[model samples]
Target: MVNWQFWKRRTPARILRLRPRGELSDAVRVEFPELAPDVRTYLGQAAYLQLGYFETLTRLIRATPDLAEKEALSLAAGAALRKHLALLAEIREEDADPAELMEPFREPLDAFRRATVGARPRETMLTVHITAGLLDDFYLALASGYGERGRRVARILRADNDRRQLAELLTETIRGDEEWRALLSLWARRLVGDTLLVARGALLLDGDGRGEAARAVEPVFTALMAAHARRMDALGLAS
Candidate 1:
């Protein structure tokens, strides 16, 4: 049996590792000269997280027992992986080391995977979809502060259709089953909380010298929570 509790307890320490190291490298500075240093760092960190999200989706697809559901997840995962790679390629074009750029985010991503290792298939799907929505909002917010290249990158990262499919599936699954509705509601809330915790930590990490960046990210957080509540309502779950 998987020890899910152990993974959850270990997540916070991993989240702490996400704090900004401060100061952009010369390569990154040159690569995104039009953008602020904090914006560059935020974009880099968001890209790393996007890569990790796809990796986690792949794992979830493999763990799923239902062939139909697995296929759906596989399609989403493929799309997500392609988008992540494209974003990374763009970064590489800037002469930055993709590996070094993503290295700091590995631990927190790994911790998230471990924490949700034994979740039910539906739970995993819901978490993935919700997380993607939150990320899309975050990227959009940051993209607005950058140049055309940043806007294009953020646009490519949005998985709106995929997230909608998953959300519909989740809604269908929980409908008319009181126990399942209750259980999934709690699970969704928990996942939302965990995601927000990491997000807050990430924002605070960048807050030291980038107070405006932190303030700019606040609306994304609010929008995510509001969207989550609407999703829960759609599923007949308590918000």
Candidate 2:
């Protein structure tokens, strides 16, 4: 139903302000002629989610008083914004209206933010780490059936090692604090459940007419849970 080729001749201002046209990668040129409309819409919503998350992280970083911690959050936020912009550019090239694509996700993402708001810096960092990891797993799962361009975008989304440094910082900060560790673990589990709900919606929307692709749900959830367990273990939390 959405026009997949709306931006064929015109570049959106928001994207153009982020990077010049010549600097944009041509690697996202691969065709996905068989990709379903719902799938594309889902991808567009995912992009907006990333953008919204980055915005919230920026606010959190500004509110943080510790110079070192603020710097770490800043780095992670900048990297995430860059990656999201690249993904949006790719989606835009396929004729998706960046604004329209993000509209449906606005209320849902806002509700998610409201429901999972963290109280402290450590808790916030843990939330960011767990959320990113789960999203990466979901993207990797969907990328399994994507064309070259979609896969490339997925790789960009998954390449978020910049945030790992922040995770280590948080881990060390809460190392011997039993109460904090328990709190963080609890928050992480809650975020995982919330993220799973969003991922399921996206996957189901993506499965409209593609039967074989639809069947990937179970394997993807399994993989995501396994990866999440490993992350908890890395943070010295009980999985």
Alpha-carbon shift of residue 200 in model 1 (angstroms)? 2.2
What lDDT, from 0 to 1, does candidate 1 have?
0.58
Q: What are the per-residue Cα lDDT tens digits for candidate 1 across 1-239?
A: 22112122112111111111111111211111122234335546667777766877788777778787777777777777777777787678667777776666667666865665435777778777766665555455455444666657656765443655566678888886777777887777777666665555444333242465455444445555666676567666777
lDDT for 231 (candidate 2): 81
Clashing pairs in 1: none
Which 10-residue window in model 2 sums to the lowest lDDT? 12-21
Model 1: weakest 10-residue lDDT segment is 14-23
Q: Point out where model 2 deviates above 4 Å.
A: 1-39, 205-216
List the RMSD of every prediction in angstroms: 9.5, 9.2
Model 2, 118-232: lDDT tens digits are 8886777777788767765565445545466656766676665477678778778669788988888788877877877766555322424246544534544655676678788
For the record, the alpha-carbon RMSD of candidate 2 to the native fold, in angstroms, is 9.2
lDDT for 184 in candidate 1 is 80
